[model samples]
Target: MLAAAALAIAGVAYSSWIFDFIVPTGQDRFRSFLSELEADDVPWHQVYSYGDIVAGVAAVGASLLLFGVRPAGRGATTAVVALGVFGTATVADALAPMGTVPIVHAATSAIAVFSLFVTMGAATWSAFREDNWPIMRTLGATTFALVAIATGWMLGSDRLQGDYLLGLAQRIQVGAMSVWLLVFSVGTWSSTRHARRPKRVPRRR
Candidate 1:
């Protein structure tokens, strides 16, 4: 279930790039944000909006599963709660369209991003404390750093040069999160699988 949710989140988040190849959105991949594809003016914008809704729902489900599977620790609890917030804010972002309600959209987007950062940071802390799944810990740290750098670049591009890199930066940020989620999902599945495996009894001697 968690793996499915992770896939849904990653897929919907990056599907804009796939749509770019097949659709004729008036928005530029470099200058425009992915949200532009879901704007009222764009063709099939409803699809993008629905995708966000699905992704957000999936993220929330994953958070529930995380809560169930996480080791006993406040860090793990924090991670789960933060992920739920991220998911909720993502859905709110979709509800408040960028074109119709730019201010609300921006606010929700900020909340989503901030919550994702908290989710990653707290998850990494929990992972290190557990002293297992080193790869997940590394991926969480890397994803957090990448998302921060890309988001900073996207926000600063307007002052530095232009908004040319805004879309690219946002894409990179989402991509990092997607990669981390994929790895985490797989790791979690593996752990659950191992835990469920039945131990064989040795033959009586």
Candidate 2:
């Protein structure tokens, strides 16, 4: 499901570029903010908006499954909430376009991005706690840390040349998160019965 979400996200992003719906995402002349694609009444922006909504909804399902698989774990709960927030933001973001309602759009974007960071942390901690999936844990933690750093740098570089890198930074963050989620999803849902089950909480040593 998370993979589907990632595909939906990438589809719209690529569509935007293919149709020239907005400036190319990573160029200096291009704005990094996803809202810009739909905010200014760009043509067929509803397509982009709805694409985000699809991604968000799929993520919500994946999160819910995580929650269901391990309701007792605090990490699972946190992941649920974080991804839920991300899903909510996408809906709110689509409803409030930047041009018609700048404040609402900005608020939703901030909320979504913030939730994304939290989601990464929660996912990393959850996988890292499991000894069986060493590779998954390592990749999750590494991606989480690196994306967190990039997000921080992007947030901190206000009014500087660093701001110019916002496009790249934002993509990096999204891409990293997508990779972690995709890999984690695949691992969790592996065809092997042993791998299909969620990792249970280890007993107290």
Candidate 3:
């Protein structure tokens, strides 16, 4: 459980704030996509690529651990699988950088984003079905809703403005997903602890 939590925290460390710190001059977080930072011409492009790889590995490790200890239900199982898919696709995205292979990068990026959406949505549904950890469940539902909204806005922005606001939209979408991941980490920890607790017994009168 501690390992799982650590992996989740490592994944969250790839947040936009960290990216902003490493981002080179002339790269606008609000105007340029995160992938732009991994371009060949960008200074320390390897740092951006390595960050994605680390975050992707962390996501995969956390998902595997959660799968082993996740609540016994199909919804929870589906959520874990979705998270794995997201992580795998993210790794692929890093390998196929937009600067090197635009087509492959786009495809992998789509898969990563879609799977992340599914991860949050499935987690919310599973939490509701399991009826455990009210706080986590509530957070799951709220973050899922926020993520959905952000995704929709991001897609719409891409279609309408043609990249003017796409970067901002993507950042917001990822921010919401990060929030969901944090809640998921807490829920996983709680679930693991619950599973290990000794069952209570009535004392003899």
RMSD, one per candidate, in order: 2.7, 6.0, 2.2
Worst 10 residues of 2 by lDDT: 10-19
lDDT of 1: 0.74
Off by over 4 Å in 3: 22-24, 132-134, 162-164
Model 1 lowest lDDT segment of ten: 10-19
lDDT of 2 at 151: 75
lDDT of each: 0.74, 0.61, 0.76
Per-residue alpha-carbon lDDT of candidate 1 for residues 1-205, written as tens digits (9 for 90 to 100): 5544574565456344456658777677777778788778788888778877877777788787767776558877887788789888988998998888999999999898889889778778877896534556776577778878888888787568644587788778777776766666665666666667999999998
> Could you give candidate 3's per-residue lDDT for residues 1-205 as a string of tens digits?
8645755664575563455665554677776788887888887777778877877878888778776665467777777888888888988998999989999999999999888878776777777786644445687788778878777887787778455577787787777777777777777777678778999999999
Give the per-residue lDDT of model 2 (tens digit) for 12-58: 43233233324443324233555566644566666667766776666
Q: For model 2, which pairs clash?
A: none
Instruction: Give the Cα-based TM-score of candidate 2 against the true structure.
Output: 0.72
TM-score for each candidate, following the candidate numbering? 0.85, 0.72, 0.89
lDDT for position 126 in model 1: 76
Error of 2 at 3 (Å): 9.6
lDDT of 2 at 155: 67
